[model samples]
Target chain A: MAKAHVYITYKNGVLDPQGEAVKDALSSLGFQGVGDVRVGKYIEIEVEKSAPDEIRGEVEKMCQELLANPVIEDFRVEIPNGNNNPQPPKSEA
Target chain B: MAKAHVYITYKNGVLDPQGEAVKDALSSLGFQGVGDVRVGKYIEIEVEKSAPDEIRGEVEKMCQELLANPVIEDFRVEIPNGNNNPQPPKSEA
Candidate 1:
């Protein structure tokens, strides 16, 4: 089994109104000096009995076709342990 | 500047129909053996000149107050270097 993690965000040039609203909310709530707040979607897929590369390809297709809006959004996929763990260990060896 | 990565997903036991729909869509598209497809949100907040721990606290409050729904959704925050670098190095040094 392989798990694919997908992150979908607006293209850099695209304006994200939702993110702007959230920023305003934060400022109002007394979070000082917040710079930019951008929101996106994160999706996880568990593909059974498929190679990591195959799962990656399938998920990328899904992202292009439905998971993200190509006109304004950009998406990325990562297969955990295939290089995406972003968190530190509980204890160093 | 500090960048914070936030991942928000449905709490365990919560129904994720969007994820289910996507799973069915994948099946229709002929990708076989896809299992447990789940969807969530990814948010990035850029805060200027703050300590890692302080940024963590602010983001957590933001998550609770507006970013994520405390009822059905759960959220987590990661300060890039505070311990999340899941990707392997480009070259073994």
Candidate 2:
């Protein structure tokens, strides 16, 4: 199994109203130092029984085809070696 | 100046329907090896002339108060040393 962590963010020139809203909210909340705020997406994908490189490629394709808006966003996919396998559910207690 | 990168993700027990939808879309597109998919938010906040620790603290408050739903999401904040400063706008030419 392999896990791909994808991050998608608006390109520099794109207007991000949500981010702006958050920034304004923060200022109203008294964080006067706050400046630029950009909001984006993070996705975790697990691929069963696949090579790390293969999982990386698939994630990139997914981001391009469905996960990100190519016209306004940029995406990055990260696959950690050896730690790529999905972990067994951890016990809470 | 400081920059805080905040990642907000669904808590373990929360249902992520959007993630499931993405998984189904991938399967339909023929990526059988794909398994669990989880989606979240990534936010970047720039704070002017603030200590790194102060920025981190402010981001946590921002996440709890506005950027994330405390009942269903968990957030993490990262403030990289030196890179904490907001980048100067770059010229295309």
TM-score, each model?
0.84, 0.83
User: Candidate 1 lDDT, tens digit per residue, A1-93?
Assistant: 778889888877789999999999989988888999999989988887467677777777777676788777877888877855453211111
Which residue ranges in model 1 land beyond 4 Å of their true spot?
A: A84-93, B85-93
DockQ scores of all models, one per candidate: 0.63, 0.62
**iRMSD (1 decimal) for each model:** 1.1, 1.0
Clashing pairs in 1: A85-B86, A86-B84, A86-B86
What lDDT is reached at residue B46 by model 1?
Answer: 94
Task: Point out where model 2 deviates above 4 Å.
Answer: A81-93, B82-93
Give the per-residue lDDT of model 1 (tens digit) for B1-93. Answer: 899999988877899999999999988888788898889989999988568888777788788877888888878888987755442211111
Model-by-model lDDT, in order? 0.80, 0.78
Q: Clashing residue pairs, candidate 2?
A: none
Looking at chain B only, the TM-scores across the models are: 0.86, 0.82
Best by TM-score: 1
Across all candidates, the chain A TM-score values are 0.83, 0.82
Best model per lDDT: 1
Q: All candidates: CA RMSD in angstroms? A: 9.1, 10.7
